[model samples]
Target: MSQNSPTAPFSAAARPELTADPQRRLGVLLSHGFTGSPASMRPWAEYLAERGYGVEVPLLPGHGTSWQEMNTTGWADWHGAVEAAFTRLRADHDVVVVAGLSMGGALALRLAADHPDDVAAVVLVNPGINSTNKQLLALPVLKWLMPSMPAIGNDIKKPGGDEHGYERTPLKALASMLGGWRQVRADLAKVKAPVQVFRSVDDHVLDPSSVELITRHVPNASVTLLHDSFHVATIDNDAPRIYADSAEFIRSATGV
Candidate 1:
């Protein structure tokens, strides 16, 4: 996994889709966080796929490629990929649930806000909505001078688990992520789907304000606090809880 490699088609660890039962009519679209590949969401997707649900985990543009390539892309490119996946799921299923991790959560919220009738429910794990990091205030200026900063992946507390994300964080792409957060935050009221958010109490990557902002606006959004996980709770110790709770949430929301 070189940081200078060229962008290619989905790799074995990049994107994986599973078709459970053709007649299930229930679909799920799971998106990975910024700089992350489908590897992070594979386990969760598989869990649902094995239970007779159509699942698609897409690799966002510039991800699963190289950090340099990720630098060239923006939030629009990432959101576009997720939106396309969601559209495909809607076409084949009577009900669709959108779930994501970190920045992917922001994208899911955006989709729910834009297509409320299409999304049956929304589930997020350690979603990155707003950041309290002071460095972000200088992103507009820093992105012109510095191409990247330290990596922000692999925040899982479970040892040996990997998120398969970039080792370097691209500033320009990060600024674009922040822009998406701002947009989603403003339109949170437009999200009419049932929202279920899982927050890790010990997450080191995201600020508490992020979840606060989400619950404040999403009207009746349910928040589940993870006591024993870091930012990447999808692969952390509480992963099973997320899987089980989300499964129940989807079943209860859509009656599938």
Candidate 2:
């Protein structure tokens, strides 16, 4: 699609790539959140790529485009994209680390659960596995009536930071996301990889219930608090902490 097209699958500012490094034996696959583009995860991917590690940041299907287009796709489409990237990285790298933000985190966890031996570790920032929002329960009926609700993008506290996600949230796509959330939570115990989570102290998008559910099920998961940032901590003030800590987690988990 043309970059200027309104229906383009990606934003002009967002640069998504499957970066391959033949010399690097380690790879990191980073996934962006639901309705969001690779723009949010680009900086994190660049950090790992600059350190000589292979990185893959794929744009989820139906995302980066308009919300109406996103409503046509489902969770399987998004997960399939991430799984493909992981499989490709596993073929080339000695070890692979999977990391994500929000809904992306749920996808990463699902990958670790499904392929325990292939994933070296998992890093999550403000993952959304469970929600206390009662409005979600009405999604099934609301999707047929209303096409979308308000946008949930650019929840970052930092100035001039934009996630480049959809301006509206498609209800049908959100219902599909809820299914993915339930499946991931059901298989949380199957995740054998070392998992590290970074949670924000003041998140406008997700509640603490999500974090509580994840830590309650996942075995020996470590949680860190981001005091200054909001939901999009990957681009907030605490982003450096996430980058540094995740690198350390990868090294310790993979023995690299």
Candidate 3:
């Protein structure tokens, strides 16, 4: 799922103080997973911004509002949102790296493929490319009959480092994610930008073999395995590694 900050920002005061130097040319567009908010990605955005890389973590449609609102939205809305974010980044930065967690990773991969010229590289953390979890696939049918399921995770991991949210999930929402993953896989061959995929061996949600399938299909992909983390490796035990490795991969790809 894509996430941002704990709550929506009211104005400029809610954002981190960034430099106004337009000449400082580096940038990164961050996408959070489905059923999540920009709050989940804000920490990483802050990390990169502090290092002088301008970053924008956008709120996807249906997200950061309510579960019912998210159910009404689909993959197209989410992709369009990211596309707009990338367009703005391209107009401002010399180098742009796309990064995401879970479903957000799928969106990032799609952007890298469709806009290869605009993206310098990509970083995926436990990307929910394909559901290794069979239970989720079965959820849609159940959701059709019963829309809301109990919350999936123990807690919602926040970008400001808080884990609190309704565990109740919308079945249709997960179905939308599966559809997006299928589309992303179909376009994998076109993603020429180098990719760094971080997957946790202990990820409870995604199948471990999904990592191998990703490396095999992605044209220029490198894989990193996290032995001890869960699905949210971006904020779990291996978070530091994911953060460091992503920065290194971006540096290598952009030659910065």
Candidate 4:
């Protein structure tokens, strides 16, 4: 079934309704990266769901569609998607942990910081906090000057992955991402959840400094640097590593 957009949520009304069973192991909310779909988090979601944890991987606004749609939307819509999923999970589970990829990591961090009492824990993969990548940071103004700019470097998994990207990313959207990260970083002290961050030592898109910032800012944080993969570690060669780490973190935090 095709997923819903930001404003149009999938009709949970049609599926057999899930009972609010408090005895279930735990609930995990998976957030995908910017310009990505639930596809990015589906593997992690499936793993958690199969292991008796209720999991939700909602598609963010202006994503999983044509790039033009994403260009029109802002980061707030993406955060809204995360907030909506978290609220739903809270209704049925006593504990909720979040796992996010790239930009989604930023959203997860922001949510944890904002609702410290509600979020039990978080697992971040290649979280893009301080994007010092010169090529990406200069895209906004550069795009305006040259409307048909060449595509950014191929940053996805090597063998196969989503290739549908914005031919010309809206400069405003790029700016909004950086701005959101700044805000998320500022509120790191408010985040009480124990965070486990996975960094790709060979990541081409984000610098090591971003991971360092994440580890330093969060009050309680742990870092693991993976050597083999790039930015999309969730689907790359080291995906199993991410899966194992996330599951372990959930178990540790919720005592499940």
Candidate 4: residue pairs that collide: none
Error of 2 at 208 (Å): 1.1
Give the C-alpha lDDT of model 4: 0.74
Model 1 per-residue lDDT at 126: 91
3 against 4, candidate with superior lDDT: 4
Over 115-187, each residue of candidate 2 has an lDDT whose tens digit, in order, gives 9888889999999999999988888999999999998778999998888888789999999999999999899
When 1 and 3 are scored with lDDT, the better candidate is: 1
Candidate-wise lDDT, in order: 0.85, 0.84, 0.73, 0.74
TM per model? 0.91, 0.91, 0.85, 0.85
Q: Runs in model 2 with CA error above 4 Å?
A: 1-24
lDDT of 2: 0.84
TM match of model 3 to true structure: 0.85
Positional deviation of residue 12's Cα in model 4 after best superposition, in angstroms: 11
Q: Candidate 4, residues 2-51: lDDT per residue as tens digits?
A: 35333122222111133234354467888877666666666666676666
Residue 242 displacement (Å), model 3: 1.8
